[model samples]
Target: MDFKTVSTIGLESSPVAQALAGLRANEARYFWNKYKHEFVTEPAANNPAIVARVNTILGERDTHFETAPLEVSDFEVAGVR
Candidate 1:
């Protein structure tokens, strides 16, 4: 399975803006892998077990974001646009 993701956001600086940005990217990756099962499986559908597993994995990560927008797009069948 193949998945493509795109993210766009605007950030406001307080003092440690760069550090916070790095932290945010790390968290994004963390959540990306945690919730990637839905994108990696065939026959797109919701699986409670898979979601539970994702939640479990994310629960182990300790990260915080002041304010950030997130988006998750799904496209099961990919062909010519």
Candidate 2:
């Protein structure tokens, strides 16, 4: 597979970086082994459309969440969104 394994989120901070990396690796391994798909993640700041959609859903239910997300990941396979 030609995919990058570690997530870029929270890498600058020392405390959580290792744990996050392990989590990302574990998720990747699971998908790769079972579904033959690469698990990838991106910073939430980079995905406006997804953020908007999530916020819209939250609005419909009148729920209040924290201001921003630390990271956001999309789980997809076979080019489906």
Candidate 3:
């Protein structure tokens, strides 16, 4: 299986980028070792569907948050969405 790197665009200047990158690397490593599949990610700005879904779910629960996500990831296998 091929491994894909996670996207951390706007997070470059963030103090937490290192930690987040480590976490993403760990997740990718786990998936590669166990399922032999790649873990991929993209900037949230590039994935409108995911952002809409997340906001919809939050709206359903009447929950509101101020911070918007800078990156997004979707995990899928066997044609599942």
Ranking by lDDT: 3, 2, 1
Judged by whole-model lDDT over C-alpha atoms, candidate 1 comes out at: 0.40
Model 3 TM-score, all chains together? 0.64
Worst 10 residues of 3 by lDDT: 1-10
Candidate 2 residue-wise lDDT, 11-75, digit = tens = 54545676767776777787788789866667677887778887898899998786565556676
Q: Best lDDT goes to which candidate?
A: 3
Better of 2 and 3 by lDDT: 3
Give lDDT per model, in order.
0.40, 0.68, 0.74
lDDT comparing candidate 2 with the true structure: 0.68
lDDT head-to-head 1 vs 2, winner = 2
Question: What does candidate 1's lDDT look like per residue over 1-81, in tens digits?
Answer: 222332223224335545545555555565458654333222113444554444566667853445322222233333411
Best by TM-score: 3
Which of the predicted structures, 1 or 3, would earn the higher lDDT when compared with the native? Answer: 3
